[model samples]
Target: MQRGLSGQYEIGSVVGQEEVRAFVPAPLPPDPLPDLAGERGRLHEQALLACGRLDAITALLPEPDLFLYAYVRKEALVSSQIEGTQSSLSDLLLFELEETPGVPFDDVVEVSNYIAALEHGLGRLREGFPLSNRLLREIHERLLARGRGAERQPGSLRRTQNWIGGTRPGNAHFVPPPPQRVESQMADLERFLHDDQQPFSALIKAALAHVQFETIHPFLDGNGRMGRLLIALILHEDRVLHQPLLYLSLYFKQNREEYYRLLDATRREGDWEAWLDFFLEGVLTTANGAVETAHRLLDVFREDREQVEGTGRSAANALRVFHALGTRPVASINDLAERSGVAYPTASRAVEALEGLGILREITGRRRDRVFAYWRYIAVLNEGAEPL
Candidate 1:
C-alpha cells in the first residue's frame, strides 16, 4: 500500500554551501501497523518456529559456546564485509592468535572491533542493561575503538550532516535526518522498543526497529554495522532466543539489492509489510542455516573424536588436545599444551598424531612456534563467510 512518504523532509544546508533536504523520520509503531495477515503472517509464524528449533539445538550440544565462538566471529567478518572490508574468518582467527604480516591489518582490526562491540553489547545486556540509545553509543564506541573509523567520534552521535552514497548531500542517494534531530529521533526509537503496549511480536519488532535505525542513520560512521547489530540485540533482549545464534548478515549480504530496495520502499511507500516479508524470510533462512551448521560441526567433532580414540596408546593425550582445539579451532602447540593441561612434548606428540590422521593441519610453516588448525571445523564455519 502506497501510504505516502513515511516522514517529512526538512530543508538543510550541507558543507556550508549546497542545499539538501534532510529526512526526519516519524516515530515508530508505524502507522496502520504492519499488515501481519495472510502470507506475511505465515512467514512470521514460520520464522518463529525456525527460531525455536535453532534454540533447541543448542541444548543438545556439549558446548554451545564452541559454536557461538566461531559463529560470532563469522558474523563479525560477514557484517564487516558488507561494509567493504575484505577480512576473512581465517584472518580474524589468525589475528586473534597473533598478528600475521600478510593479513589486511586495518581491515581485520575493523572486523575484530566488531567482535568486541558485539561481546560488549551482549555482556551488558546479560548484566541487565536496557537496550537504549546509550547502549548503542557504547557499542558504536567499541566498534571503532581501534579500527579505521576511530577518529569519527566513536561513541558520539554525528554533529554534522552525513550522506549515504554520493560525494555530497545534494547528490547523495539518501540523506538521513540532520545532526540536530538525531537525539530526538533516536529517543523516539527507544520508546518504540520499550513500548509494551505495541502489538508487534518480537520478530516483527526487530524487523521494524532495524529499518528505522538504518533510516535514521544516527551515527556518522558505523551506522550500517550498528543497524544490523540492533536486530540481534532486540531478539536477544526480548528472550526470543536463549542464545545469540540467529544472525541475518549472511542473508542480507546475499540479498543485498532487494534488502536495500525494501528498506527504501518502507520509507517512500510506508510499506512495512514488504520489509517484514523479507526480514522474516531472512530469519527463517538464517535460523535454518545455523541449525544445519551446528549439526555438521557436531558430526565433525564426533568423527574426529572417534579417529583420535582409535590411535592406540596415544589416544589419551590426543583427545585432550582435540578437546582444546574444539574450544578454539586454531592454536599453537604451546597454547594447546597449556589449555589441555598436558606437557609440551606430550602436546606436540598429540598434535603430530592428529596431524598424521588428517584431523589437524599446521597453518604456519615455521618449525618453531607454528600454529595448528582444525581444518574441518574451520572449513564448516567458513561457508558463506568469504569476504565480498
Candidate 2:
C-alpha cells in the first residue's frame, strides 16, 4: 500500500548551501500499519518457520558457540563490505591473529571493529540491558573505536546534517533528519521496540525497525552497519532466535541494488509492504543458507577427524592441534602448541601431518612466525564473503 510520503521534509541549511530539505521519518508502526496480509502474510509465515529451523539446527552442532564465532565474523565482513570495505573473511581472521602483513589495515580494522561492536551489544543484551539508544551508542563507540572512523563522533548522535551519496547535502541522494529531530525520532523508535502491544511478530518488528534506523541515519558514521546490526539485535532481544545466527548481510550484499531501492522506495513512496517483502525473502534465504553452512562444517569436522584417526601413532597429538584449529581457523605454530598443550616440535610435526593430509595449508609462506589456516574449514566459512 502506498501510504504516500512516510515523513515530511524539513527546511534546513548546511555549509555552502542556503537551503536543504532534510527528511524526518514518521514514527514507527507506519500509519494504517503495514499490510502483512495475502502473499505478504504467507511470506512472513515461511520466513518465521525458516528462522525457527535455523535456531533449532544449532542444537545439532557439537559446539554452537564455535559456529556462532565463525558465523559472526562472516557477517561482519559482508556487512562492512556493503559500506565499501574491501576486507575478506580471511583478512579478518588474519588480522585477529595479529598477522597483518599484506592485509588492508584500514578495511580489516573496520571489519574487526564491527565484530567488536556486535560482541559488545550481545554481551550487554545477555546481561539484561535494554536495547535503547544508550546501548546503540555503546555499540557505535566500539564500532568506530579505532581505524579510519575513529574521529566521526563515535558514540554520540550526529549534531550536523549528513547525506548519503553525492558531494554535499544539496545534491545528495538522501538527506536524513536534521540534528534537532534525531533524538525525538529515535525515542519514538525505542518505544516501538519495547511496546509489547505491537500486533506483529518479532520478525516483522525487526524488519520495520531496521528501516526506521536507516532512514533516521542517526549516527554520523556507521549508520549502515548499525542498521544491519539492529536487525540481529532485535531478533536476539525479542527471543526470535536462540542465537544471533540469522544475518542478512550476504543477502543484502548480493542484492545490493534492490536493497537500496527498497529502502528508498519505503521513504519516498511509502511502500512499506514492498520493503517488508524483500526483507522477509532475505530472512528466508539467509536463514536457510546458514543452516546449510552449519551442516557442511559438521561434515568437514567429522571427515577430517576420521582421517587423523588413521594416522595411528601421531593421531593423538595431531587431533589435539586439529581441535584447536577447529576453534580458531587461523593460528601460528606457537599458537597451536600452546593451545593444544603440546611442545613446539610436537605441534610442528602435527601441523606437518595435517598439511600432508591436505587438511591444513600454510598461509604465511614464511620460515619463521608462519601462520597456518584450516583451509577446508575456512573455505566453508568463506562462502559469499569475498570483498566487493
Candidate 3:
C-alpha cells in the first residue's frame, strides 16, 4: 500500500515505490533459543524425559484400545478448542462460560474442522506423502469455512498480495517476508520437515517450524490457530506421539504474553531455546494432563455404571444415557429420547431410574417441560459448571 503525502491511499509494488517499506530479508542471528537459561535451563532434558514418558503412555495403548487413547485425547482437544475462548485454563478444560465471549458458533465449528483437516494432512506427512498446495489449500479452506477468513475463496491463493506486521496504515509493527521470500521460506521449512538430521532435537524443530510459520505469517488470518494446530501435527507426524492430540492452547492461553514475546524475540533477538523449551514443556505437560483426564473419565464411567446398572430398566440403555450425559449435560427428556433411541415412555423410565439413583438432578421444575441433568457427570467433565 502506498500512502500519499496528504494521507491518500494507493497500491503498487513495494519494489519500485521508494516510499513503501520494502521488506528485505535480514540475516537472522544464530539460535539464541539455547539462552532460555533460568526457567528452562533443564528444558532440553525435561523435553526428552517427557517424550519418554509420553512414549510409555503410548505403549500402554493395547491393540483394541490403541486408538481409544488417541480418540479421547482428540475429544478433549475438540471439546476445548471448539467451545473454548481465549481465557483461563479452567475455562478451556471445563468449558465454563458465564458470559459468552460472543464468538459465533460457526467460527467454533470451522476451527474444529480445520483441526480435523490438519490431522488428516499430518497423517499423509507421516507416511511420506508429498505435501502439495492443493492439500494445504484444501485444509486451509476448510479452516476458513463459515468464518472470518471466508472473505477469500476457500483454499485459493490470493491473487493480490498480503502482508503482516502492520497495525494501522501509517505505522505497522513488522512487514511479512516479502512476496519473493514466501516461496523460499516455505520450501526451506518443508525441507526441514523431511530432514532427518537438522542438528536439533524434535522439540527444537517444533519450535523452529512454529516460529518460521508465524514469521512467514503465510495466511491472511487463522495463522495463530493454524500454527498451534501445526505443533500437534508435527508431533504426530514425527511419531513423537501416536495421535495428533497434544495441544498448547491451554498453555498459550495461560501465558499468552510470554508466548507472543518469545516468538517476537526470535526475530528481534534470537531466543530459539526459550521458545523451544516452552513448546517442549507444553507437549509433556499437556500430554500428562490428557492421560490423567482420560483415566478420570474412565473411572467416572465405571463408577456411574456400577451405580445405575440393572435398575430393572434396560441396563444398556441406562448406560447409554450416562454416555449421552458426557456430550449433553443439560438434557431434556426429548434429548434423552433421541439419544437413547427408545420410545418416550421408555426414555422417561430410564431418566426416572437415574434420578432415583441420584445420577441426574432436575433443573427445571415444570412437570411437563421438565429438564433433567447429569449433574455429577457434567461436574466431572467441567471443573465447575458455568455453561457449555
Candidate 4:
C-alpha cells in the first residue's frame, strides 16, 4: 500500500532566499481508506463499542455540563502541554479563580485560551454553524488571543513558508506547501468536509481530517493544537457523541514517537491504514478511560456526600459546600461562600466540617486565604493529566 508521493511538491523560494521543494498535501476523505475489512474492521467495531459506553456514562452524570466544566479544562491542559505548554490543571483552575500565584502567566493564558476556543467552537456548532475553514480560523483566533503565539497572525493562515522540526526550510524535516497554495489546498479540504457523494463513517472522517489538517499546517502557529482540536470538533458536529467527551491528547502524548511516525508514514508511504488504526485505537482507549473516570468520580461524590451527611447539624451547610466542590474541585473559602450562597464564616465552618470528614484537604496549609482542594475528586480526574 505504499503509494508514492502523497501529494505533488512545488519549487518555492523561502523568505526570498533558498528555494525549497515544499509539500502540498492532497485533499481529504482519502479515496478507498485502505480497505477496513479485516483487522481494521475489528478495531472499528471496538471503537464504536467504546464510544457507546462513553455516551452511556455521560448520560448518567447528574450534570454532564458540570463534569464537562472540569473535563474540558483537563483536555485543554493536556492538548496545550503536547505543544510544550507547562501549565498544569491546578494552574488552570487557579488562573480561572483569578488568584494566580506560582503559575506561569503566559502558559496559563495559553491554556485558558484553549478552553475559550473549544467553548466557542462547541457553541457555534450548537447554533448550527457548519464546520468549515471559516470556523477553524475563528477557533484559531480565540486560541492565540493571548500568550506565546498571539503575534503569529492568530486568525490568518501563514503567508510564508513554514516548516516543522528544524530551524529553516532547507534543514527542516517537513516543509508544508508554499503560502500561495494554502487557499486552494484548504478549499479542497472544505469541499471534502461538505461532500455528500463520498460516504465515510464519522470516525473515519475525523481521523482523516485530523491528519490532513496537520499535514496542511495552515496556520503560522498553533497548528498542532488546532489540528488536535479538530478531531473532537468533527465528532461532535457529526453527532457521534452527545458531548465533547473524547480527547486523544493523553494517548498521543504517551505514544508521541509512534504518532509522529504514523503521520509521517501516511505522507511518505500513503499508509493511511496505519494512521487510521492508530486513530481508532486512540478513540477506544480514550473513550473507555473517560467512562471509567466518570464512574470513579460519581462514586467519590456519592461516598463523600454520605460522609458529609453524617455531620448532623452542620450537614446542610456542609452539603452545600460539598456540592460546590463537585463543580469546582479546587476553591477558596470565598469561592465556597459565593457559590454556596452562605456567609464567609458559614463557608469556613462548612469547609472545616468537610475536612473533618476527610472529604476536602487544605492544599496550601496556610492561616488565611488558604486554598482547599476536593482531593479525591481532583485525584480521580487527574489521572493521566499530569503535565509532561
Better of 2 and 3 by TM-score: 2
lDDT of each: 0.90, 0.92, 0.58, 0.87
lDDT of 1 at 174: 90
Q: What is the lDDT of candidate 2?
A: 0.92
Stretches off by above 4 angstroms in model 1 are 1-4
What is the TM-score of each predicted model, taking all chains together?
0.98, 0.97, 0.72, 0.96
Report the backbone clash tally of model 2.
0
How would you encode candidate 1's per-residue C-alpha lDDT over 11-46 as one tens digit per residue?
766575877788777889888777898988888899
lDDT of 4: 0.87
- At residue 134, candidate 1 shows an lDDT of 97
Position 39, candidate 3: lDDT: 61
Query: What TM-score should be assigned to candidate 2?
Result: 0.97
Give the C-alpha miss distance for residue 9 in model 1, angstroms: 0.9
Q: How many residue pairs clash per model?
A: 0, 0, 3, 0
Q: Give the alpha carbon lDDT tens digit for every residue of 358-383 in model 2.
A: 99988877888888999999888998
RMSD of 1: 1.8
- Candidate 4 — which residues are off by over 4 angstroms? 1-3
